[model samples]
Structures are given as C-alpha cells and as structure tokens.
Target: MAHPYLAYYCLNISTIPENSSYQSSLSSLLSSISLYATSEFQFNKLQKFLNISDPLYGLQLCHGDVTTEVCRECVATVAKSLAVVCSRKLVALIWYDECMIRYSNESFFSTKNVLPGFALSNIQNITELHRFDQLVNTMMIDLESQASEVPAGSKKFKTKEANLSELKMIYSLVQCTPDLSTTDCNTCLQEAIGTLPVCCNGKQGANVLMPSCYVRYEVYPFYNIIDTAPSPATGLPPLPPRELEGMMNFFFLIFF
Candidate 1:
C-alpha cells in the first residue's frame, strides 16, 4: 500500500484528444501492461503497443528486493493510477516505493535518462557529517560497480551494509533497469550517486530516483535483506530478515 513518491507528465507534448484513435490505443496498451505485469510475476517488464497513428512504449519495474506478491500489487496499483492521474497525456511516469511505471509516445528503451529525476531526504541529519559522507560514498561506489556488472538478462541490482558506529549502521540499495547495458547502468548509477551531496548532504537517509536507475541509503534497514542474496565475489553471507513485511502490512492498514 505504498503511495506514489512522484509523478511526471510530458507537459510540453500535446495531450491526446478525447475519443481519438490514439486515446483508444493508449487504453489498450495500459490494459495489456497491467495484465502482463501482474500475471507474470516479473520484476521488470517492457511493452510496446504498435499503432500506425501513435505507438506507446511502457515499462514497469519493481525493486529487486521486493517479493513477488509485493511486486504484483505495486505494479497493479501504479498501472491503475497512471491511467487516471495522467489521463490523455502522451507521456508520463509514476514512482511508488516498491515500483515505477512509465509510458511515452516515443520509445526510451535501453537509454540512460537522468533528467526529470528527484531526490528525497530525511529531516534528521547525521551528527558525524564528514565521516558519514565518506562512508556513503564508498559504499555507494562499491554497490554501483556490483550492480552494473551483472550479466545480460540478470537484474542490475545490489545492496550493501556498512558500520557507521557500534550502535548505528548504514544500509544501501542501488538498481538499474534490466534492459540497460552494463556501461549504461554504471553511468546512470554514477550520475545518481553524484547528486547526493547537492540534495541530501548529511541527512540520515535519502534516495535519488531517475527513470533509468535509483539509489537509496538509510540509517535503519528499509529494504528486504532476506530477498537479497550475497554476492559471490564478496563472499558475504545474507543478512538476517527484518520485520519489513509486518511494517508494510501495518502501513497498508493505516493508509489503505
């Protein structure tokens, strides 16, 4: 029951006319994407609806650490919301905590997109500012390397934890759309990591969301560790499970 973190519409582009052929095609494209995303239990899906008048390209992506159930639910929710919130728009993108959905009249597949990105940071700041920043940079750089090195057809995602102090720890996750090449994924994540200091400097937690990739770090465990396997190269064991599912259920109960 996560709500949308942000949404973007192509305001510069003209909107589709009501009851036009392009509008009808858009509806059908959304329906197909919704059905396939929910039924396939996939972490990522890219779809295109071909029409002589207007073609639509759409993509749906769930965080790599999310469960199939959560992924399915998130995709379904965003798909329905995109149709309503960006009704008649030629291009739009929506981001939820667990998933993101995007559609455009022009295809953006396999490209690195950094514009129209956003950053969100917690209000609380870290007391050890310089030291914390160094750690975040090191950990994020390592994670970006790991995530972007994945083989073709594998998920371009990685997570890591680092000790900030005896009582505090930093948890981070980074991911790129699976469709991107290794070089493209690395570039996308690198650009995203470069923005932390400008937008989130020393906040306890922050996230940068782009159309091609995202990176996040928190003082507390915000991602599902159980679903993240240890990287063979690192020789690290999987982290213990946290009460994330229960927290999600509670969130849904209160919000939905």
Candidate 2:
C-alpha cells in the first residue's frame, strides 16, 4: 500500500554559451529557479503560482494534478542535480513526477522529438498477462481520445480508470512545455504513445518521455493534492500537474 498522494514537478535547463561566459549562463539558468516554487496545497489556502522572468531561455510546466510538497521536492531535486549532469550541453531533460522543466538554445515547443529516449519496467509482472495487456490497450485508446480533446493551453493532464477488477486502476499523466502551442503538445504526446508497445511491452508499469512531453501508466495512485477554494471550488493560481497508477507512476521532468 503506497501513498496515493505523492506527486512532484521539476524543470531542467541546459545552454551552450558561444563565448563561454559561465557567469551569464549561470544567471540565465538561475532565473527560472524562483519561478518554479509555489504554495499550491495549503489545505484551506489557495494555490499561489510564482511567475518570474529569466535572463536566458527557459519554460515551466506543472501537470495540474499534484500537491505543493511534491512539486517543491521535484523542482528542488532538479535544481540541485541539473548542473552536474548537463555540464554545458546547451540542452537537457530532467524527469521527475508528472511534470518537467526543460530549456535549450533551440526551442522545442510545438515539436516532436521521436528520438526514442528510453523504455523500461519494474521487476514484477502481473499474474494475468493476457488480460492486463488487453485492458491496457483499451485504456490507452480512451486516454488518447480524451487527452486529444482537452483544450490546448497547457497540455498538462492526468487520467485514470479502474481497468481490471475495479480495485486495480489504470492511471496516466501527459504534458508538454508551456512554450508550445496546444497542437504541438498533442503531437508530441501522440509520438510518445506510438512507442508504448516497444518501450514498456507487457510490464506492469512504464513511462515514455521526451523533453517536451511524456506519458505514463502504473497500477497505483501517485498524485498529490491540488489547492482549490472550498465553497465554490473556485480556481486558484494554476499549479503543475502529475498522476500515476498501479505500480507505475507519473514522471516529473526538468528540461534545458
């Protein structure tokens, strides 16, 4: 029994300095740092979003389906690890919960990478492989249609339904960089969906992610709370998003 509310968000950026000015490059990278934090899940309080400008190139996206704590943790982790991994690549991707942070010299918004990034599974497998596979196929079809129909603005969405015995649910989350138009986000996600069969195969859970977008499926609940005004269900400042299911889960990402 894992905690159902354990979602997070992160942003990662990588840049190549033509003149190799580390100072300016570092400043640009740090500009988006403050923009990443927020007060989105304070029980009674409203979700407070932070919007700060950066000196260099950057973009931020929260999956709109997670708690503030998880969001903060994921962003903090990327902020800490980005420099070590990217090391002046001028571009990078840091994957975490349901959301991600990324930036590059060349904009990736509204674009599909089709680079075949990665694919893997947990050690465990379902007892009924055939039934589980069939269910997953049906679930993906439904998710694709729903997500395709969501209004463009952020392309940050998470969806789930009890697939097998009702007790076992199928969950997923998908997102694209805010910098991209809605259509591009949709396009990127479609590309990701195409690889699910090759990537995760018959595994219990898995995720497919690119710098701009990603999709995931698991057997357990893996999203945090969202801050909303109680009475009217009034909307608060927009927060990030994340969701996962079964043993699989959402992937928070940072891009640069």
Candidate 3:
C-alpha cells in the first residue's frame, strides 16, 4: 500500500558523486532519522562525516499534532522511498503530510528558504470570492505573528478560527521551525502567504508547505482546537490535529 503522504510531493534537488563512501554516509543519515527524529522533540538536525571532504547535514520534522509513533512511521517510509527514488542524489528534500525530511552537503539550519516547496488547494472556490480572499489574507497574517515568538520556541505555532458569518468560519494555522529567528520566520511566512492569490485565491482552503515553515487555512474546522497559552520557556510548538494525513488529493502548485 502507498504511504499516506507519498502522493503529495517529492523533491530530489542535487545528486551526490558516485562513490562507496557517500553510499555509506547516506545509510548512516537515514538510520539516524529513523532512530532520533521521533523523540519528544519533533525536530532533529544531523551532521555526520564519513572520512570524506564533505559531511551530510539533515533535518527531519513532523507536524506538531502527530504522536511520536506516527512520526517514526513517516520517517521510515520516507527513508525507504529516498533510497529508491533519490538514490544518486547528494541533496534531497521530501515532504509528506505529517513530516518532512531534508539533507544536504551544506548547512541550511536557521536560514530562510522558500523554494523547494509546494502549495495545495481545494478545487471548490469560495462563493463570496473577493471577500473571502480578503478574510484569508488577514487571518493568515495574524496567525503568523502569533506563531513565531522566541524563548523556548513554544510560540512558533498557532491555530485560530475566525467567524465569517453565522454559518461560516475560517480555521487556519501557521508554523516555523524553532531553529529560525523571529525575523526569518516572519519573512518566510510573508512570502508563503503572498502566494495565496496566485495559488489558492478563491479556493475553499489552501496549504503551503516549505522546509522551514508551513501555512494552512480552511473553511471548515480541519484542525483540533487546542490551548494557545505561551510557554514560560522556549520549546517545541504544540501539536495540532493530523487532518492533512487524509487529504491526499488536492491541486498542487510546485516551486523549484
């Protein structure tokens, strides 16, 4: 059976030079992800050397809402997929509904990257198209502010809903990797939100996933409602519901 998120997107950026040592290093990195990426912390960064000039740097993250078990299963599935699909690549990034895996010969931690991401949107457009677009834009911008606060990093995620009318509501979420500075997080979110007009304007919902951050808004209550209390110390963000896991079908607009 196909993995829950395999149908969404896979990015194979650059290929590594053919060599036995690189192969061994690849094995090491993949093994590390399966073992360490699903700990209490949902994010892990890895840098390992294999008696070679360059070392492999990797980052793995799961959506905050998933359990550790789900994170492990997702990572294992992606590791197996990378072996077959990105066999010769030195640098690759693969994103699933619940998790993302990226490795490179160079460092990307704490840096802002908007490329190598994809946007997914619903096929049905909103009835009050223009007004709905305005609401979405404003809602996402507000969510971005609440999700990127510093300290123990607990503020790097937020989920909120706004009433459009008696019968309509807009639920949205925004998140950034804890490694990013508040400035970078805001910048990254701005770029992602700006793409809505072109990628998801008028749509009933949209999700923009990037290596460093993610933004999503839907008409219905897609995510589980949770407390928004700020943490006393910096830390990982709270887990939201895993609604995306079952949303395998959507229109994809990819960015390379």
Tens-digit lDDT track for model 2 on 1-256?
Answer: 5432222222334445544554355445644453455644211111112233322354444555656665666565655555555555555555555344454554454455544254434435677778887877777656666665655443345465445664565555555544455566667777777777765666777777666666766665444313211222112232233223333433322222
Rate residue 231 of model 3 by lDDT.
Answer: 27
Give candidate 1 regions above 4 Å deviation. 1-3, 38-50, 229-256
What's the lDDT for candidate 3?
0.73
Taking all chains together, each candidate's TM-score versus the true structure is: 0.84, 0.67, 0.83
Report the C-alpha lDDT of model 3 over 1-256, residue by residue, as the tens digit.
4444533333445566677677778889988987896566578888888876868888887767667888898888877777776786877777776677888877898788888778888766789887788888788888888766654344377777776767777778887887888888998999889887878877788888877888888766554454432321213232343544444234468776
lDDT of 2 at 94: 56
Q: What is the lDDT of residue 69 in candidate 1?
A: 80
Model 1 lDDT per residue over 1-256, tens place: 4334444444446898999877877787777766666433354455454456578788888888887787777778887888788889988887777888888888898888876787777667799998899999999999999989996567888898888888778889999988889999999999899988887886887778888899988777776766674532233343332332222221111100
Q: How accurate locally is residue 249 in candidate 1, as Cα lDDT from 0 to 100?
A: 21
Give candidate 2 misplaced runs (Cα > 4 Å).
1-19, 36-56, 225-256
Ranking by lDDT: 1, 3, 2
Per-model lDDT? 0.75, 0.51, 0.73
